[model samples]
Target: MNPEKALVWFRRDLRDHDHAALSAALSNAGQVYCAFVFDTDILDALPSRQDRRVHFIRESLAELDTALRARGGGLIVRLGRAGEVIPGLARELGVASVYANRDYEPAAKTRDIAVAESLRAQGIAFHTRKDQAIFDGDEVLTQAGKPFSVFTPYKNAWLKRLTATDTAEWQCQGAFAPGPAEGIPPLEQIGFMPTDLDTIGIQPGMSGARALWDAFRAGRLARYAALRDYPAIKGVSYLSVHLRFGTISIRELARAALADESHAWLNELIWRDFYFMILDHFPRVVGHAFKPEYDAIRWAERPDWLAAWQQGRTGYPLVDAAMRQLNYSGWMHNRLRMVVASFLTKDLGLDWRLGERYFADQLNDFDLSANNGGWQWASSSGCDAQPYFRIFNPITQSEKFDPDGKFIRRYVPELAAVPNKYIHAPWLMGRLEQEAIGVVIGRDYPGPIVDHTQAREETLARYAVVKKTG
Candidate 1:
C-alpha cells in the first residue's frame, strides 16, 4: 500500500545513495519530499560560531541537494529546533509519514522521541531505520544475552552474526518523488563563518569521501596495518570525518573492506559500532566513570597544566606535538590521540574530562560516544580500558612511532633543527649543543611542564586508589 506522500528527513546521514530512510520513503510513497534541519537546538549549544563540523555539514548538504535535484526532488533545509521543524514540515507538505535514519546520542534520542510524538499527534507516521552502523546497540550481544563490554568478544560475535543481508546496500532505485525546491542556506546565514577546513586538507561531502576511499584503496590499504601506527606516514584512511558526518554509508565502507584481504580497517569500523553500543547501553559513561570504582581516584586540579596542554605548550615533545596538531588542524593522528590522552590523564594527573572537552572542540570528526570511549579508555575508567598501571611514556612513544621526529618537527617547528637524539627531549641537549643548534631549550621552546619520572611515580600512587598493580 503506497502512501500519498512521505517526508524523508536527513540528519547525520547526509548522503543520497545507499540511504535507508530515503530508499524506504521513495519506495513506499507516491510522492517523497526530502528535508534537512540545521537544528538550532544543537547549534546554539556549540561553543564556537566558526565550527569546522558546521562548515563540513554545510558543504555536504549543498552536494546532497544537488544529488536529490537530479532525481526530481530537492532538499528542504531549515534552521530551527528539529522537534518543532520536522513536524511542521510534515504538515506543510501534507505528508502521510516521516522517514529518517536513527540517531543514538542521548540528546538525539530525546529529540527523536519528541518529534515522533508530535508527528503522532498530527496523525502522521514516523519511521526510523539503522543506517549508521552495521550492527548498533544490542544487535551483537554475548552468549548470556548481554551487551559485550569488551571489544574482542563483541567483535567475534559480530563477525559470526554477519550475513550478506547486513552489508547489502539499500539501493535507492526509481525516481525520487518530487517536492518543493528548497535549497541550503549559506554558512553566514546560519550564523556560522568559513573555517580553514580546506586549507587543513579536508574535503567535505560524499564525493570527497569517495575520493579519499579511492586513494586509500589504491596503495595504503595494503600497508594500513603496518603504517597506521606511524604518524610520520599517511597510513590511516582519513575517512573518519566522513564516517562521523555520514557523508558515506557504513555498508559501503564495510563491503569494500570485506572485498580486501586485510581486516585491520574493518576492526576500526567495529570499534565505532562498539562505542555507539556502549553509549546506548551505558549512558552514564557520558559524565561518570564506566567502572564505578575508578571514580574514587581523585584527579588533580591543575588549571595551569590544563592550559599548557590545550595550547600545545606541554614540555613533552610528542604530547605537545599531538596537541599542536589538533590546535592547528581539526585532526590528529590516532596514535598521537592515545599518547596525548594517556599523558593528560596519567602523567599530568589531570581529569580526563578536560582533555575530552578539548578534543570535542578541536577534532573535525568528533562523535560523543567515540570521544568519551577513547578518553575513558585512556584514563582506565571505562569498560575494556587500559589497566590503571599501563600509563604511556611519552618519550618512548615518540621514539617508537616517530623515530626521526618528522611528525613532531612538522607540528613543533621549534624543535625542527634539533638533532634526532635530542629531538624528542630537547632539554637533554648540553649548553654547547644548544648553542650549536641555535635553539635554546627555555628560550626557543619551553621546557617540560612536569618531570616524566616524577609524574609517573605520582600517577602510580594516585591511581593506587583504584588498583595496586600496574
Candidate 2:
C-alpha cells in the first residue's frame, strides 16, 4: 500500500538519481516532497564562515533543486537543527512518512534517532535506507557472523558477495509533488560566505562529478595502480569530493571499476566501505584507540612543532609541501596524506587524534571514518594498522614519489632553484651549494625540524608501553 503523502529529507546524499531514500519515497508514495536542511547543528561548529565545503554544498543544492524542478518538483531548503526542522516540515506537509538515507557518523546517527522519535510521535513513519556504501552494518561480516576487523578479508568478502543487482540504480517512477516556490538560499543568506572553489579548480555539482569521472575513465584508470602513489602526476581520480557529497553514485563507480577490471581502483572504493563498516561495528574508535592498550602511549606536548606542521613550516620539504597543499587547495594526494600523517605521529610524537581532527577540518572530502582509519593506521592504534616500529623517512618518500621534486617545488616554491641532487632535503646542501642554488637552508627554506634518526628512537621508546602491555 502506497503512502498518501511522503517527504524526503535530503542529507549527505544530494543527487537526484540512484538515491535509495528518494526512490523508495517516489515508488511507495502517491506524491513526494523533498527538502534539505542546512543543519545549524553542524554549521554552527564550523570554524570558518568561508568554508569550501559549505560553498560546495550550496552550489550542489542549487543544481539539485534545478534538477528536481525539471521533473515538476523543486527542493525546499531551511536553516535550522534538522531534529526540529524535519519533523515540523513533515507535519506541515501532512506527510504519512519521512524517508532519508542513513548516516554512519555517531553524531549524525544520534541526530537521526531524535528526528525519528519526533516523527513517530506525530504519527509519521521514519524510514532510512543505505545510499553511501556498497555494504554496511553486518551485511559483509565474517563466516562466524562477526564483523571483520581486517581489510583484506573484508575486501575479499565484499567482492565475493557482489552481484549485478547490487549496483543497479534505484529508479524514481512516481511523480514528485511540487515544493514551496521559495528556492535555495544563497551562501550569505545561510550565514556562509563564498569561497575559492572556482579558484581552487573544484567543480561542485553533478556536472562536475560526471566530468571528472569521464576524464578518469577515458585516460587515468588504466595506469592508476602504477602512478597513483606519485604526488606529482595526475594518475588518480579527483572525484572524492563528489563521492563525499553524493553528487555521484557509489554504485555507478563500483560498476565502472568492475567493468574496466581496474582492481586497484576498485580496491580503493572497497576501502571506503571497509572504513564505514569499521565505524559501524566499533564506534569507540571515535575518541579512543581501537586497540585499548595503545591509549597508554604518552604523546609529546610540542606546540611549536604542531604549529610548524600546520603552517607548513616543518622544514621537511615533503611534509611542508603536503601541508601547504592541504592548506591552499583543501585536498591532498593519497600518498602525501600517508606521509604527512606518519610524520605527525611517528616523527613529531603527537597523538594521531590531533592529526585526525586537523584533517577533518581541512579535507574537502573529509569522511570521519576514513580520516580516523587512516590516522589510526599511521599511528599503529587501529585494526590492521602498521607496526609502531615502521616510521616513514620523509626524504626517501619524497625522493621515491616525487623524484624530480616537482610536487615539492609546486607547493614549497622557496626551493624552486634547488638542484635535483639536494631537492628532497635542501638542508643537506653545503653552504656553498646552497648559495649557488640561491636557497639558504635557514633563511630561504627552513632546516628539518627534528632529526629523523632521533625521532625514530624516541618513537620506539614511546610506543614501548603498548608493547609491554600487549
Candidate 3:
C-alpha cells in the first residue's frame, strides 16, 4: 500500500538522479513533494560567516531545485532547525510519510530520532534509507557477524561481499508536485556570505561533480596510484566535496573503481566506509582515542607552537606549505593531510583533537568520520593505525613528494627563491647562501620551531604511557 502523499527531505544527498530516498518516495508514494532545509542548527554553529561549504551547498541546492523543476517538481526550502522544520512541513503538506537519506553522525542520529518521534506523534511516518555509503552498519560484517575493527580484512570482506546490485541505481520515477514560486534563499538570508570558492577553482553541484569525474576518468584514473602522492600533480579525483554533500553517488564511484580495477582509488573509498563503520561502532572516538590506552598519553600545552603550526610558520617547508594551502583554499592534498597531522601530533606534541577540530572548521569537504579517523590514524591512536614511533620527517616528506619544491613555492612564496638543494630545509643553508637567495632564515621565512630529532624522541617517550597503561 503506497502513501497518498509523501515528502522527500533532502539532506546530504542533494542530487536528483540515483538517489535512494528520492527513489523510495517516488516508488512508494502516489504524490511526492521535495524539500530542503537550511538547517539553522548546523548553519548557526559555523565559526565563519564566509564558509566555502555553505557556499557550495547553496549553489548545489540551486541546481537541485532547477533539476527538480524540470522534472515537474521543485525544492521547498525552509530555514529552521530540521527537527522542527521537517515535521511542521510534513503536517503543512498533509503528507502521510516523510523520506530522507540516513546520516551516521551522532548528532544527526539524535536529530533524526527526535524528528521521527515528532512525525510519529502526528500520525506521519519518517523513513530513512542508506545513500551515503555502499555498505553501511552490519551490511558487510565478518563471518562472526560482528563489525571488523581492522581495515585490511574488512576491505577484503567488503570486496568479497560486493555484488552488481549494490552499485545499481535506485531509479526515481513517478510524478513530482511543484514547489512554491520562491526558490532557495540567498547566502545572506541563510546568515552566510560568499566565499572564495570561485577564485579557489571549485565548481559546485552535480555538474561540477560530473566535470571532475569526467576529467579524472579520462586522464588521471589510470595513473592515479602512481602520481597521487605528489601534491604538485593533478593525479587524484577532486570530488571529495561532492562526495561529502552527496552531489555525487558513492555507488557510482565504487562502480567506476571496480570496473577500471583502480585498486588505489578503490582502497581510498573503502577507507571512507571503514571510518564510517568505526564511527558507528565506537562513537567514543569522537573525542577519545579508538585504542583506549593511547588516551592515557599526555600531550604538551604549547600555545605558541600550536599557533605557529596553524599559521603555517612552522619553519618546516612541507608542513608550512600544507597548512598555508589549507588556510588559503580550504582544501589540502590527501598526502599533505597526513604530513601535517603527523607534524602536529608527533612533532608539535599537540593534541590530535586540536588538529581535527581545526580541519573540521577549515575543510570544504569536512566529513566527521574521515576527519576524525585520519587524525586518530596520524596520532597512532586508532584501530589499524601506524605505530607511534613512525613519525613523519617533514623535510624528507617534502623532498620525496615535492622534490622540486613546486607545491611549497606555490603556497609558501617566501621559499620561492630558495634553491632545490636547500628548499626542503632553508634553515640548513649557509648564511652566505641565504644572502645569495636574498632571504634570511628568521626574516623572510620562519625557522623550524622544533627539532625533528628532539621531537621524535619526545613523542616516543610520551607514547610510552600507552604501553605502560596496557
After TM-score superposition, the amount by which residue 306's alpha carbon in candidate 3 deviates from its true location, in angstroms, is: 0.7
Task: State TM-scores per candidate.
Answer: 0.98, 0.99, 0.99
Model 1 residue runs over 4 Å out of place are 1-3, 468-470
Q: Cα RMSDs of all predictions?
A: 1.5, 1.0, 1.0
Per-residue lDDT, model 2, residue 84, is: 97
Clashes of each: 1, 0, 0
Put down candidate 1 lDDT per residue, 328-362, tens digits, no spaces: 88899999999999999989999998889899988
lDDT: which candidate is best?
3
**lDDT of every model, 2 decimals:** 0.90, 0.93, 0.94
Quick one: RMSD of model 3? 1.0
For candidate 3, write residues 369-443 as lDDT tens digits. Answer: 999999999999998998999999999999999999999999999889999999999998999989998989999
Candidate 2 worst ten-residue window by lDDT: 172-181
